[model samples]
Target chain A: MTALTLHAPILLVALPLLGAFATPLVGKLGKGARNTLIGLIVLAVAGLAAMLAIDVFGSGGIPTVYELGGGTFTFPLSGGQVPVRILFEVDGMSAFMGLITALIALTGAFFSFSYWKERSGGNLYFSLFLMLIAGVFGMVLTGDMFNFFVFLEITSIAAASMVGFRVWLKQSQEAGFKVMAMYTLSGLFVLLAIGLLYGQYGHLNIAVLARSIQGSLTDMVALGLLLTGLAMKAGAVPMHMWAPDAYGESPAPMSAVLVVNSQASLYGLFRILFTLFGASISTGTVGWILIVLALLTIFVGVTMALIQSDLKRLVAFGAVSQIGYMLLGVGVGMAVIATRPEYGLVAMQGGIFHMINDAACVGLLFFASGVVIRAAGTRDLNQMGGLGHRMKWTSIFFAIGAVALAGVPPFNGFASKFLIYEAAFKLNPFLAVLAVLSSIMLLAVFVKAFQAAFLGPRSNTSAHVSDPSLGMMLPMAALVLVVIVFGLFPGFFVDHIVTPAAKALWLGRDAYINAVLGG
Target chain B: MNIGNLPFIVAALLVVLGLYTFLFKRNLIKLVIGITLIETGVNLFLVTLGYRTGGISPIYTFAPEAQQMVLPTPQALTLTSIVIGLATTALLLSFAVFVHRHYGTLDVRKVKELKG
Candidate 1:
């Protein structure tokens, strides 16, 4: 491999880190120039990440390991044997997230041009945006547990700052603080878990630790902390109270990207479960607990969304519910993997596919809602009415996103949700029933949102609103295309992308362990 | 009752105390302090993990006279955690200062303009 190709994983992270710090200097070029630079930077990163992803996915879909700071040795122990080292391990799943993050982040940056054009602290906005991207990439790709924690902190800190971007708004600051508190506590819990593992094995590298994990009481305790903390980050119910606050309070574009951030935590959970603890832990019990959490998350998010009148809050709840489909699919997969391997693989495929679909559909919805808020200057559904007449394209985008998210036919949501519902039924018929009913509730919830926010006669407050500018409409249009393409060709994605990703999680454990250990 | 477990027990207690204060406290400042305490506790546990019965300094460059060395990895982990703890603590504190500047109070209950 060429040096550039050999270093794709590190470049994926470092390029963004460089851009994050360097953007302030670039921002001196003025708003229009600054925005163009930021857009170009994100777009470039997206292309590079997509290239790396396709390369890895093309190469027989195996785990690709990159030892960080240029070395192949795992760790230099006192006996001259290597136990562990800092590394970036990229597989189908990591590539999947990197691609999704890049896509959504690029969209978020493009949309921000129109969304935050006149806002102050635009320099800080670009810096944090890049840093958030870098942090998330690091989190998903890192091979070591401690590096994951460090990256998690970076992502949360950047996300909290972005959430508090509207510092003039009191609730924005509150949301920022709330997110920060949750992130800090979660980081510590994760760190403590890492400590337990390290104390037992003297290695923090996931592959080494996974090889050595005994699943003892200490392991169970560490697993408990990891599960709880990662679940909280994923916004699973019971501790999901913080999700709406943070997701709803952020600007629309930031909210779009935040969807992927939530998914990254779920990704971490899956990685540790299937790779780190796989074959070591009792998969049956872990899967059942996840299933329980998934059901609660699905029900609670839908029920909560039903009562929300604020447009952003409604979609935030919808986002939370979408996470259930993913967890339900993967949870069922894990639950049954030890018994029925085929069903488990299919379940995981469904969940993994759902992650990308959820990111796109939710991102489109958030951007559309942002468009409505921007044009009509309100997020309250009660106050927003009949913008469909003036904002034609925006309304169309919103309708497409709403239908797609609700699992209507010919939409990507239906495709993945179908896989999940079918696989879940194989596990147990009741899960399928609940999954179907919950999705129907999601449809009802968004239909209400559509009726309240986009349907009625134009209210007095929105009388002057019209179609948003091209800069805003373009991103929405791009998402509309994504929704359509994915919907139309779900089978293609399922075979090429989704199945390989699930395989990487379920079947690639040994390959992953060997990549670091064998070297 | 053995003294070997004392540091670990103390670390666990610190963590529990921090979680209690973090979850139950009303004041934002107190909540931030709680997070710092938990981080410190975690750092302590990490350092404790590296402790060997008769270990000397892990620095091999000087070739210390003592042979049995405590694990150096946890100490490295602890140092990284401490650095990260500093960052999170600083970020949270700044946010707290911003909260006070915005709302004129440190009470979290009073800061709920975003609640459902």
Candidate 2:
């Protein structure tokens, strides 16, 4: 293997962390220098993610296990059977998640170039942004439970700080506090679950724990805590109260990154359910619970979004509803894991595929919203109008994002949602019907937002509004390109990356354990 | 109840009490305190996981020849948890300060600017 492939996993996480700490110092140089530094850091992280993804997917989904404090692939410590050192086990699923994070981080960094131009504390802002990226990479890459908790905290602190970055705004402060409180509580729930598992298993390694778990009372309790905590973090309904506040209050670019962060949490939840406790637990029951949560999340998120006056908050609700589709698609897979139904894998592929689709479409929407807010100087939809007159590119991009997010045909969202609808219909026609109904509602919601924001006669407030600079427009354009490409060739992506990722969760449990434990 | 289970019971009680405070408390500072209480409870639970009836320190140097030693990993984990808890508490308190400054009250009900 090339040296890049050999150390890609750790470098993917470490470079951003090192760059985060170095950002303020780099900023001391000048704006040009600071931007250069951040750009290089993000580019390097993205390159590493690509290398890692290629390696994992190219190897027929064989996971690359990197052992810290030891050589690569070291297993069964010298004196003990359990691996004591930290390990980064990057399978197809992890590589896929890493790719999503890298894409979003790169675009966010690009968008922030102009977004934070006039804002003060640009240095600290980028620093926290990079830190959040690092935390997410670590969360997705690590193989140890304790290490996951640490990265979880890292993401929590950085994300909460970023959400509250606009200290001048009282609403930002309120949102930050509420988000921090919820994040910490959920984090503690994860930590407590880890503690319970450790108390019984005497090992923090997920593979080791997975091998030995027997679904005891304590294991069940740990499972409960983990499910609740991760579900809350993933913005599932009833536990997703903090999402709109955090997403709406944060700077626009950070909103996109925040979406990826929640997906990382969702990644964690899937990892736990599929890999760690797959054989030990009654997955069907848990799957039903998730399905219920998914249905509620879908219905409530769209309904709540419909009434929002604020543009970002409305998109935030849309983002929350999107999470339900992912849960529903994967929850169906989990429900039929034992039966190994042919459609189950298709359902999983749809869910896993939707993650990237959502990232692109929602991210494009947020980026476009950022431009609109900056140009119009307000987030209220009621105050925004006729933006399309001056900002043609942004209007087109916003329309694309809205249509794609609503799962219209010939777009990335429809490609994945189609799979979900097909698979879910076979499982239960009611689920498919509800999902379709929600998609229609989502279309109406975004149409209202689009018409109110961009389609009418030029309001006095938007008289000065115009398309953003190249730095901002490029990211949205890139996302738009992704939406089109992925839409046109969903089968290509699903066949190559998405299927392997879905299979990694569906049938790669033994392979994951063996990769780490060397059975 | 067995004497051996007392620490676990106390830890659970502390966690329950902290949850009660977190759910019922109105003041922002009190909410921070509630989170801290929960962290302390979790930390205590982590430490107790390694406890033995009559164990020595986990250190190897100058250790007694025959006596048992408590597991050191849990202690290490607890210390790390404590440090992380400290960082989160500081951040939460800073946000609380900001909230108080802007809203002029720590009562959560009064901090309603972010509601749906």
Candidate 3:
């Protein structure tokens, strides 16, 4: 027991991974038994994560670094440096992500209990869900670049497959194809960049590579490739075309999982920009390039969302726009680092804070859309009217989600966006003005969503549209409550959690190496 | 152990050719071929990074008194990378089969049901 508890972090990953393999065998026990077994395991994992988060952050903050393979340092390079072989560093940021991931997975698994169809390959769904959890957890925990890429592949492949789980539908298959193509291609670019870094410095660990490699042309090339690859995964504009189709095609529970997954990519983007490259490398054209991308991403994402008629696609596109907001915050931080590095801290804090808020709010929005879709049997706005009359709980939840998404005060979105707006304005007034424009547009758009789906007169088949099962409504209700609670009390999330994270990011090179490789 | 040898140049040329195939190939299989070529190029680069003048393999059993040992880390990483490439190639090919089954076509432009 003592030995098992000592390796708790590793067990967090190995548990789901082993569950993914063991699920098939467990499924053979009996019908409907697989999901129950997987749920029990994941619930335990979630509980473990919550406990770990509490332990890590109970005092100020705890940074636990583990050296893999017997904890003995093994030098794998000619440079005589201790090569990091499968290192897992658990800090506040990872602990936070771990908590959210486990919570969402637990809620999602609980929700999926009644959601999966007997004929819908339920066993496979459970298997993939476990694998997805493993991948996300690994992504947050792993310190080595190669392992990060491997986890990225795992998450992407599982997601693409799940996106097209309904293979009979041509659109699902097409969405799957497009997603697979983009994700794999982006992964190839990331691999090339990793190779570049490895060639320059004979190391694959992010911490060691950052220390050994400096701001050379090779570093720039590597950064560009890595940024482009990660941007594609983050669904930044131009590379974002695959997202709506993929999200729209996936099951609602799966879509909720995907919302967290996309946010996970944003986490990766943040880690790479602030954590991997540090402040010095983050300045100059790199910062400006991200700024341009963020500006366009917000403008393009919101505008595109405004024009969408399909409910799910509209929410998916709204996600793209929201990603713009986070990117904007990060870009502003990058731009500020060289001049007034203090402002960079605020910008990064706001950006990282928004990442958490956006995940919760947008995740709820997608979950609500899923409920509406399942109830209405159609995703088109023209067909969904007067649902508020019958599906009272859903209507209330959807409204809460929409309000939060639009950055309304006293809601979670408003708190994060407030900080983001302040940071952007402090850096560049022009950026603040543009962000305000996008926020106003976001408000108008979600208002349209509320009006069209809830407030309007009953369409022809509106009477038939009923609320989803209690299982589905419950998870979304919890998320909505969280949104409200976080909004009302933003300090708990921002000050204790996000501020330290952003400050850790702001320490520039020292923090970067310390976070990944430890002091 | 010449600084600029023909094998190195040939390896570089092979990589370029592979990239060209990736960019210009219309068939899905050929694109996979291009990716494989790119992986080979990367692996070659790793091996080349380890290459030292007159240095032999890092195997201690064959050359116990060897003063120069070619970097063994890159060789191990390249081996892992080669395995990853194999897995990717296999997954890509299997996806191609599925694509063929559904679309009945492999022409990149023809798979256009997902266009805007």
TM-score of every candidate: 0.96, 0.98, 0.91
List candidate 2 stretches off by more than 4 Å: A72-80, B1-3
DockQ of each: 0.77, 0.84, 0.35
Model 2 per-residue lDDT tens digits across residues A1-519? 697887888888899899899999999998889999999999999999999999999999778888876764354333335677888999999999999999999999999999999889999999999999999999999999999999999999999999997788989999999999999999998999999999998999888888888899999999999999999999999999999999999998999999999999999999999999987899789888989999999999999999999999999999999999999999999998887679999999999999999999999999999898888888999888998999999999999999999999999999999999998898899999999999999999999999988899877877887898998989889999999999999999999999999999999998888887776
True C-alpha contacts between chains kept, each model in order? 0.82, 0.74, 0.12
lDDT of each: 0.86, 0.92, 0.76
User: Can you write out model 3's per-residue Cα lDDT over A207-270, one digit (the tens) per residue?
Assistant: 7876776878988888888898888888888889988887777877777677677777777776
Candidate 1 structure quality by residue, lDDT tens digits, A1-519: 466666888887888888899888988988777777777778878887887788878887767778776664532223335445588888888888888898898888888888788778888988888899999999999999999998988888888888986678877888888998998888899999999998888888888888788989999999999999999999999888889998899888888777788899999999999999998889999999999999999989998998998899999999999898899999999999889987888889889998988999999999999888887677888877888877778888888888888889898888988889999999899999998998899889988888877788767776788887898888888888988999999989888878778888989888787766663
lDDT of 3 at A209: 76
Q: Using DockQ, rank the candidates from best to worst.
A: 2, 1, 3
Task: Output the number of the lDDT-best candidate.
Answer: 2
Q: Of the pair 2 and 3, which is ahead by DockQ?
A: 2
Runs of candidate 3 with Cα error greater than 4 angstroms are A1-6, A59-62, A73-81, A279-282, A508-519, B1-26, B51-63
